[model samples]
Structures are given as C-alpha cells and as structure tokens.
Target: MPQFALEPAVIEPMVEALGFELVDLRVAGSAARRVVRVRIDLPGGGRPGHGVTTDDCRRVSRELESRLEAAGAVATQWELEVSSPGIERPVRFASHWRRYVGREVRLKAVGVRGKARATIVAVPDDAHVALEMEGAVVTIALEAIQDATLVVDWSTYGKREAGES
Candidate 1:
C-alpha cells in the first residue's frame, strides 16, 4: 500500500476476511486530512433479515486502521468509515446482477435514450445480463451499462390497515 494511495486491492481482502462484502469504496481530501468511506454488506447482500451491523463496522474500521498503520500507508490524519450500502445501491458486477435477479433496477445504458426501470431476469455469462423491460427481454453486455441501481419499492412496507397517512 503506497502512502496516501489506498486502492481496492489493499482493502478488499481485509473486508472479505471479516466475512463481509465490499460494496463500494471512496477516498477523498488531501494528505492533511483524508476520508475513506467504505460501504460493506453481508456476502450476496440479499440475505433476508440479515445485514452488516455497527459492531461489524467497528471491527472493520479497527482492522483497516491497524493495517494502514502497520504499512505506514497514511502518515497524516485519516478517517476510516465502514457501513452498509444504502437502498438504491449501485449494481455493477455480474455477481450483483445474479444476486438481484427478479429485482427491478433503474438503469442507464449506452445508446439508450434515458434511464428506464427494468427487472433483471438472467445473467447468461460473466459479461452479459438479461433484463425484462417494457414487456420485452433484452440482453445487454455489462460494458454497455453506464450506470444502474436497485429500485426500492416501498409500497408493501409497513402498511397500515386503512386511512393511515
């Protein structure tokens, strides 16, 4: 790990070693004060009623701090944040597509007019994903996707009996 250069390669293994998946990683600010925000979740990120906890975040933070300190990676003041990926999390990998099959997503694709809501239907290979959009199934190469995020449907969540705001 080079000084002030924290790549995914340096963090991914540590995150995985703690039984969590690295959802996203962002580094910001100058060497004087750097902020490293890490989003983590249970592997597959689809386990019902299971999620990364605060204790999990604490452990990951401690581990990352220790590792960075041991390697003299960051000589200046730094912050390490670990937390769960929020709703509408970005979907970028074949594993994400596979894990989210049957779930709708808001997708932006190259050559497409605008973002559209589509349900992930299949992942035929590592490089392609099939989506059901507008009553038709479309297979798209992963490279064609400009961006994509899982759609959070709140209609069925915590519904009151009747006439409730």
Candidate 2:
C-alpha cells in the first residue's frame, strides 16, 4: 500500500481543534499534486436541517490548508475539499453506531445480497450491534458488516407541499 501524504493522526487533531468531528479523510496522488478529501460533522452528529453548513467547511478548509502549506506536508499545489458527511453518512465505528441508536441505517453485511435498511436499535458491545430489520431484531457482529450508513427520510424533516407523497 502506498503511503498517503497526510495521515489521520496529524489531521484528526487539527480538525478536532476546530470543534468538528473528523468523520473521514483521504489523500491521494503523487508529490506533484495531491487530492485531500475531508468529511466533517458536528460533535453532536448533526442531522438533516441542522447539519454542518458551508461556512463550517470553509473554516476547516482554510485552517487545514494553511497549516499544511506552512508545514510543507504535501505539494504546494494541493486540492483540499472539506465538506460535511451527507444525510446518508457512513456509520463505521462503534461510536458512530452508538451515536445513532434509534435511527435508521442501510447495512450491507457479509452474507447479505443487498443493502438492508434497518433501525439501529442498540450497540451491545464494541464488536456487535443489534439492528431491527424487517420487523425482527437481529444481533450481528460488527465485522460482518461491510458498510453501514444513515438512512435519511427527507419527508420526515419539514412540512410537505399539498399533493406530495
């Protein structure tokens, strides 16, 4: 595996200092040009309407970009994109699963053919989760899950217009 220019260890603290959770981070490319994609979220896990805003991304981007440039961490000309985790943001860590209990999520497990939309009922332990799927509650090892993301129902947010579903 090729080493990335920016490591999580360095970026995590910088992001947290800005009072946001570092949801995800990825750096790609060579010494000449690099692509840094950062996903951020509120410490409280912002939901739908009350989520991280454009200003937040800009704040992070500016600070992070400046710091990296001053430190000469990567190429001087690097692309830094800071944005919020979308409505269907990934729920990969135990803390994330715990944070979203009672919320619906789409899960892709080891033997599942397709992604299953289910409510995260509980986090029994660090290694397992209890999800309510298809009217039945099932306990699944965390390792069995390949992917899990929040399921957002936009209609649940604000008032819908007349004749809307």
Candidate 3:
C-alpha cells in the first residue's frame, strides 16, 4: 500500500546480483528522518547461502547508499537497512508460492473457516495456491488470503527422508 524510496524496479537487479530475493522494500517516516528497510530472502529455507548475510547486508547497504547519494534521491538523510525477512516472513506475492512449493505454510483467509496450516503442494496459477492439510488438499484463491507465511518446522528438515531403507 505504501511506496518505497527504492522502488522494486531499482532494487531487483541489486538484490539478484547479491544472490538474494527482494521480499519487500518500504520507507518509514516523513520528511525529517527516513528509514528505508529492505527485506531480503535467502535461498535454502531463507538461510545464509543465496541469502542475505552480514557481509551481504554491508555490501548492499553501501551500494544503495552510494547510489542514492549519487542520484540525490532523498530530500533528507535516510538510514538504510539490508537484512533477511527473518523466520516469519510473509508470502505476499505469487512468486513466493512458486518458490516455496513443497514447504509447510500457515495461511489466514478473510472469510475462510479458520486459520489453516499445510504443505504447499502446488501453485496452480498466479491466482491460487494448493495446500495439503491433514491428508486433504485445498486450493485457496490468493485474493482470499489475508496473510500467509512458510511454517518453519525444524524437525521436518532434520528427519530422515521417506523410503530411507
């Protein structure tokens, strides 16, 4: 709903070059002091590799700072933060569903029965997500989703794969 100082169009290339996905970008505060927070997503379950590390944050922060300085983009001084979206990252876009396929997720819909948790079985299209919940699969239209995010199950990844014998 709110616009960002660094538009997605300008940030996408920089994010991709750093081997991270640009989850979101937002600007906070008014004309006085602004804070531009960029949420980055890492590759393996949003961890380090192909993700935003401490060094990555420094590099991106410097780059963005330099770019903004050069362009004279902001009317006032702004703080730049480049960091991972953390564990409870929101899956807001269609690309998120595609990227997180086969992963467990929690979803809340506006007029749904109740909150639902399930594995993301598929992304039928840009408009819907198929989830597997308690042996039954449900396809939820994206428009209905009030909030959704990947469910971090440490045991799910730590456990042995099926048919290990």
Which ten contiguous residues of candidate 3 have the minimum total lDDT? 43-52
Off by over 4 Å in 3: 1-5, 42-51, 108-118, 131-146, 158-165
**Using Cα atoms with residue i matched to residue i, what is each candidate's TM-score against the true structure?**
0.71, 0.71, 0.66
lDDT of each: 0.85, 0.84, 0.75
lDDT of 1 by residue, 1-165 (tens): 456888768788888898888887788888689999988888878443467788988999999899889989887798888888877787876888998899999999986679999999999999999999999999999989988988987774334557555
lDDT tens per residue, model 3, 32-151: 788888877665335523445788778878887787777666668678888877776778678888988998788888666687788888998999988898899888898888878778
Give the lDDT ranking, best first: 1, 2, 3
| RMSD of each predicted structure | 4.8, 4.7, 4.5
Clashes found in each candidate (C-alpha, N, C closer than 3 A)? 0, 0, 0
Reference-based lDDT, residue 95, model 2: 83
lDDT comparison, 1 vs 3, better candidate = 1
Instruction: Estimate the overall C-alpha local distance difference test score of candidate 2.
Output: 0.84
